[model samples]
Target: MTSIALIEAAAQRLAGPARRTPLLSSPFLDEIAGRRVLVKPECLQHTGSFKFRGGWSAVSALDPEVRARGVIAFSSGNHAQGVAAAAKGHGVPSVIIMPSDAPQLKIANTRALGAEVVLYDRANEDRDALGAKLAGERGLTLIKPFDEPQVIAGQGTTGLEIAEQAAEEGVSRADVLVCCGGGGLTSGIALALEAKAPGLRARPVEPEGFDDVARSLAAGLIQRNPRLSGSICDAIITPQPGDITFPIMQRLCGPGLAVSEEEALRAMALAFLRLKIVIEPGGAVALAAALFRPEAVEGDAVIAVASGGNVDAGMFCEALERFGG
Candidate 1:
């Protein structure tokens, strides 16, 4: 389990490497949401995602000899790039197992970051089995996307920042909406809020039809998504909330929120226009909930974590074309 102490240690390890992303706000966004909306743009983070913090934390926390043996991770895109970049920075080897249908830009970026990229059929192949085989053959430590203790601790560092930033902004209370997949980011933030910002609450946001975390939170139990591969918000798609993360969320988070893919795209368009930042569909879900689903959120303000920006040009253009007003 990830505790505040572990998160502090991860923050220490990440002090020099991870970017402390800013909390941005725009009057235009405020008008749309009918609340003061602050966005924590992790899209501007290293490797174009907040996943880098988790990747670097996990890799750096390993024993030096163990880290020297290399690391492996399974992600459709963002986490893969995060791990690959972190491994390269540490002068260690990395192998990324990604779905074949994952965005080409992510796969290409992973390879360019000096990792071996293995593509699998998402519908037919077992990614975990393949990752285990590779890790065994190469004596590599597996860096799980969200389920690992170190990874969750790394993600929690973002919540620590949110706590501090909200304090700076004089926001004693608000909902911190985070894009959710296997619940790593949301649970991490929830933990940080529990420890450091009792007045602030964390909420998980998901794309519709792939809202396992939202449904699970509503049910007070783990629930599975019926489909995993079809959403345009691919970065936040997972079969269910992670076993390690769900309980943390249950204990600390507010009710989860789900938004449509079109809403996510609209959020992407708005983020670009108002904040001048690019956001992928998955990363925009929290912003979507904040902007389009204001009634479901509480408080006079809301903070949304724009989690990643590793989007393909075509998809990004499509979003801008459709909703870039």
Candidate 2:
């Protein structure tokens, strides 16, 4: 199926559960950029991230027999909560393999949603192999975090909503800035935006250390990270883009941009103070890119997807201090 069809299917599948998050114009950012800046606050989404949209769509699309067998997933954080929460809603069992260094709050949240959590060391172990083994042993289907079509289509719903919301507000078209991890959200959003508003540009933003998507898009191939940079924006720190998402992103996304760790933290603080929204470091990268690279998006209305709000309290305080809050 096409990206539009997938988005429609995801909308239908997640109709009742997933929140239709609003796209509100940010007066503060607008003043700073001298153009209308809208914020798609998916941090307010169920499970504190947009991952629920894809997770629910994937599970709900399954045949009854498959659903009965349950599902398994591997995630560092947000995706785990999404899959777990969706599984709970569907009355299906779920097992999530997460990195041992994942945030405690995310791990707890996943378990609280009634999914079994398995921790693995990301540095030394192959999470995919472990997840597949667990899935085979338990007779469960493995739901990939970002590489699956269902997941991508589900994530595309954000773009659909952005387009609809922008039109509703009398804004014809706007540049969309989305944070990239494995390219699922960026690729999906780009497709949705292309369909919804052909003139609109979709840009993927990444942290300085995790610029695999940006680099790969420029080089016209998938590239691996030589070494993970210890950026505060951990959510978008994937080592590489997914096979399913890379080609789509190459076609749909404009030139990608990278922001520094300090800039990301400042943007996070700005979102909390000015926008009154709690955004994690990763989620704030898009806004940070806009702030640091204004010339690239100058004179165009922009929509930044603040993807999640699951930050450790200590990190939040540290971000505030770093940004002079």
TM-scores for the candidates: 0.96, 0.95
**What digit string (tens of lDDT, one per residue) describes model 2 on residues 225-281?**
877766788777888999999999898888888888888889888887778888899
The window of 10 residues in a row where model 2 has the poorest summed lDDT is 291-300
Highest TM-score scorer: 1
lDDT per residue as tens, model 1, 1-325: 7999999999999998999999999999999999999999999999999999999999999999999999998776789888998999899999998889866777788999999999999799998899889889889999999998999999999999999999999998999999999988898888888999999999999998988998998999999999877899988898999999999998889999999999999999999899999999999999999999989999999999999997888889999999996
Candidate 1 error regions (>4 Å): 100-103, 120-126
Clashes of each: 0, 0
